[model samples]
Target: MSEIRKIIEDLRKNKAGMRGILAIIIIFAYGILGSYFIMGLNINNSIYYTVITVATVGYGDIIPVTPLQKLFSTSLALTGLGLLAYIFTIIINSFEENLHDIRSGRHMEKRLAEMENHYILCGFGRVGTAVYEELMKRNQKVIIIEKNDEKLEDIEEDDNVIALHANATEDKTLKKLNIDKSLGVIVTTGSDVDNLFIVLTTRELYEDAWIISRASKKESIKRLKNAGANKVISPEVSGGNDIYFAAVQPNLVHITQNHGIDFLEREFEILKKHNCHLENIEYHFPGIRTPVTRTIGVLDEEEKDHFIDMVKNNPEVKESLDVMYNSVNGVHSHWISGPDKTHVDMAIEELKKEGNLLGINLDFKEINEFTKQFKE
Candidate 1:
């Protein structure tokens, strides 16, 4: 609605063009009335003369005879011709501009339809832009939904980014982006309310999508989570934490600042590079309650047999180990478990050294719960 109003106001504010158009209208009226009064022509004949004169198509059938009529005819012909040219120029330019907009719109729509496993970013403010840059660094596909045209302009030349100038809070916009086919959504609008709304709408459209939202206030964090965000981040909180970490945990801060691994995100990228899809891999990040366990990939018949033979002779590995299979991809995967974090680290380190020799990956973290289940 605001966009339509802005366009209308812009058209109304084109004083130069409007003045020229008004002059053209008045000149045509004068040509018709002057001919009717001075040349003794009827209304229809006067209008006919006016059209031909303005069009610069003098047929010689309506030559001005009287002195007053000839002067009036000369004035009308010159002024009307120039005005008509100006008007036609404006019309042609306007037509070309509209055509370009239409072509770009259709192209964007086609790109949106073809996008799969892309991330939808709602907002292009500071927070959003930072997120976008990080994702771009990792060569991730991202679609930006922003209401401000200026923000979209910043990414106009970026081929990897598809920006839509629309309200992200609207479900229709989310649907147009194909939320179900997207990998996740990030809402970083300036307003917490708007971010919450975007999160809710995205969640309603895609239940399994990983939604990360930015919150301005502490209270908004829980609200955003309730609205279906998988992760809620506050820049202020993160900044304060970084300051504190720098003072107390200097070494840890240095390692985090210089060599942040982001194990889960890296694992996904590695799997993607191997032609393995996210849906085919099951992952769980280690937390206080949840153990860090990730099922890296699936193997075919030959790869599975070779993997088993390589690890079967190892004394550290279980004799009758469990193998997981992804029915969707028709591939098998070997599972490893550890009793604790130290044991898990040792197992992963040892297996990683031979993972290449076995023609399979064995670098995944062990889930304590999975280990208990496996033993039973």
Candidate 2:
């Protein structure tokens, strides 16, 4: 049973290659030859007949005359059928494997395209998993680069998450994950220097990507950030903060209640050519109960016209139109903050009215719960 389990694990980790299929073809050919020679069957063109029969291209030129030949023919027929079945099964399995590879390739491509606004989390250990959970709560799209085979199994169960099992600092691995397009990257390896190396490589590849690293030692923080990490967090400092909080503000010592909002920070880039009018607007509204503030950026002539039409048609918006104009950048930027539910409804109403919004992207995550637990 243990050996069988090990075999199963190995099979899951390693896909059957072309060599396996070729081996099946060889076996089938040998079976065809055995059928021909074992029964001493004679034919006008034995080799040619065997080829055609094994190839599944039967011709009437070669015929079995004797009873022995007929019996051998029957055996050959059965063997041919079995070989064909085996060949087809192998071919189908290969095709399915190729299809899966293609699907995974496409998924990685899509993840790369959004790299400019996404995060790459390296390692999938306990700490790394916690970071991933927090990122998920905030509805952040992230690519997890882990090396452990066991962790890959856990991540594979999540259809929404993409996992690449490779060295996070390797250029080839980074390129596969489209590290250049990422908005930021988090290096949380157990080794402080490994995290520093990842940050250095990521910053060099994508200067704009925010590289946040975990430093295991107190002295490594400065070196990590200096190595191009935008921020270096020392676990010791974090532990110190927790200890201080425990000693002083025991009730508020929970990282989840205060720092929980950190996980709630969502960033979205508008999808081009979307029909929703208020799509480009970035609102910081927390929940449905909070009031929202609106800030409008510069608008083009067409957008300005649409805005005017929306304000004129909606009495509520007309009464609350603080400012409406184009900006120096020539693209309109709108800021809306309010009770989450009400503001979202109002924004949607405006979107419906103007038909100008392209898309409303969301990064709705719930990190407070996990962080609160961590604090405890």
Best by the lDDT measure: 1
Q: Please give the lDDT score for candidate 2.
A: 0.52
Poorest lDDT segment (10 consecutive residues) of candidate 1: 250-259
Please, what are the lDDT tens digits per residue for candidate 2 over residues 153-239?
Answer: 866434346777789878777777666655457777888867877888877777766677777898898898789876666666563
lDDT of each: 0.60, 0.52
Number of clashing residue pairs, candidate 2: 30
> What shift in Å separates residue 217 of candidate 1 from its native position after superposition?
2.0
Q: Candidate 2's error at 150, in angstroms?
A: 4.3
Candidate 2 worst ten-residue window by lDDT? 247-256
After the best TM-score superposition of candidate 2, give how far the Cα of residue 158 lies from its true spot, in angstroms. 9.9
